[model samples]
Target: MIELGKYAGTVLAAYGVSLALLAGLVWQSIVANARARRDLERQEKNG
Candidate 1:
C-alpha cells in the first residue's frame, strides 16, 4: 500500500521529532501547573 524505500527514513524522523516536541510541551505544562498550585497554596496559608 505504501512505498518504504525512498521516504521511510524521512517520514520516521519527522514523526519522531513531532512526538518529542509534543511530549516536551506536555511536561512543561504539567510542571507549570504544579508550581502555580503550590504557590497559591503557600500564599493562602501565609495570608
Candidate 2:
C-alpha cells in the first residue's frame, strides 16, 4: 500500500495517542455504567 517515509513517525505517534485515549474513554464508560446499574439494583432491592 501506502507509503510512509518522511511522515511515518508523526503519523504513528498521533495514531498511538488517539488509540490510547479512546481505550481509556471506553474503559471509563464501562465502569461508570456498571456502577450505576449496581446502585440502581441495590436501591430497588432495599425499597
- List lDDT for all candidates, in order: 0.96, 0.97
lDDT per residue (tens digit) for residues 1-47 in model 2: 57899999999899999999999999999999999999999999999
Q: TM-score for every candidate vs. truth?
A: 0.88, 0.88
1-45, model 1: which lDDT tens digit per residue? 577789999988998999999999999999999999999999999
- Residue clash pairs of candidate 2: none
Q: Give the TM-score of candidate 1.
A: 0.88
In model 1, how large is the Cα lDDT of residue 24?
100
Instruction: List where candidate 1 sits over 4 angstroms from the true fold.
Output: none
lDDT of 2 at 39: 100
Number of clashes recorded per candidate: 0, 0
Q: Superpose all Cα atoms of candidate 2 onto the true structure and report the RMSD in Å to 1 decimal.
A: 1.0
